[model samples]
Target: MSDAPHSGVRFRGVIDLDEHKVHDRPTIYVYEAPVRAWHWTNALAITVLAVTGYFIGSPPPALAGEASAHFLFGYIRFIHFAAAYILAVGFLVRIYWGFVGNSHSRQIFYLPVWERTWWAGVVHEALWYLFLRKEPKKYVGHNPLAQTAMFFMFTLFTLFMIITGFALYSEGAGIDSWQAKLFGWVFNLFPNSMTVHTLHHYGMWVIIIFAMLHIYAAIREDIMSRQTMISTMISGERQFRDDRED
Candidate 1:
């Protein structure tokens, strides 16, 4: 196929491009170490908070032994309080990391509301979830709907729970304490401390619902979308099934 004399190079050769099938590509480094650490740490803290917080709201049947000696209820409260503090501190550290870490680290913190393409992605994701779309798009970070849910359902609700929780703690710590100094303003909005307590309780349900969806989506997308999901958070690397750019 070449015009040049004595050249051994073949100008071209034809091959079926479709003959090759690729199941993976070079992995993208997405979540950083701090972000991944905070993710699992926050998950554990959330699980403990939800379970113990539920019991704090609804007590189990009394123990057979003397109530004076047993501290089962006290233990539950301690665990719940400890987990809440862990979650709050983790969230704060995550926020700081968002500013200093990789761009993917900040995906869950904000929405691109002004972008029409982002809106299209939201609709596309919604349709995919409903089984109306045949194929799902690949993303190194969260898809649009997941990002929205994270910002509203997880992030805001986590902040609400922290503030209200500390305000409730301020009652025992007294109005003069540091907890009150920081979160006492939350009382001004609710007026009744019990009202804040109830709202905080409801926030737990919202977080639980979001968590279920997050888990289901991760597992589903890992199988159906041909991209790594659950493992991405664990190893901070995102892999796609194809070389095609998103």
Candidate 2:
């Protein structure tokens, strides 16, 4: 007997097996240009901050020559400062985009905590990840659990870092500097600049952890979930593996 008949292939929601024709997948443009730009820029800024921040915490051994001969520590601090400014400015721009950009742009900033369905979706997503559910639901944008994580881990923690970081910067900037003027209030909360430094250091680790989780989730979802994840940021298109509504 001939081998069992091969299952027909489904291409772009249109089943076409015999001809081997190419077809467009069902897709939606979710992330706009500005959102994508901010995403990549923010990622770079975070990476720079993490590396420089690590050096800031545990500096390298002293060089053999004079301090002026090698500005390794100075260069590290400069990079850290530059990346921090970029992160803060990008965050401000992201918030502005949330106001003017598409609906999905605001998802991270606004959590529909009061909605029963949203909480249920969060629970279902959790269960799905726990292997208690057979399938995960498809979403046009971030799933409820992801939205929650973005809000708490990225959004809130970013704000916390900005405040603490600038507070530490104000010490070198002098009491008259604008950074001091604007973020001096942070010092009032912690008083000791060392405490602020410690908090900022911990925040860096937190962001690093968040970045790892975010990347892993995206890659995993791209393969396991019914909807696109990573390509959505690069191409601004979210394509469903199947047309069935979740």
- lDDT tens digits, residues 119-230, model 1? 8999998998899988777777888888998999988888888989999989888999999999999988989988988998999999999899889888988888857898
TM-scores, all candidates, are 0.88, 0.91
For all candidates, what are the clash counts?
Answer: 0, 0
- lDDT (10s digit) by residue, model 2, range 131-216: 99988888888999999999999999999999888888988999999999999999788888888888898999889999999999
lDDT of each: 0.85, 0.89
Best by lDDT: 2
**Model 2, residue 94: displacement in angstroms?**
0.4
* Model 2 misplaced stretches (Cα beyond 4 Å): 1-24
Could you tell me the TM-score of candidate 2? Answer: 0.91
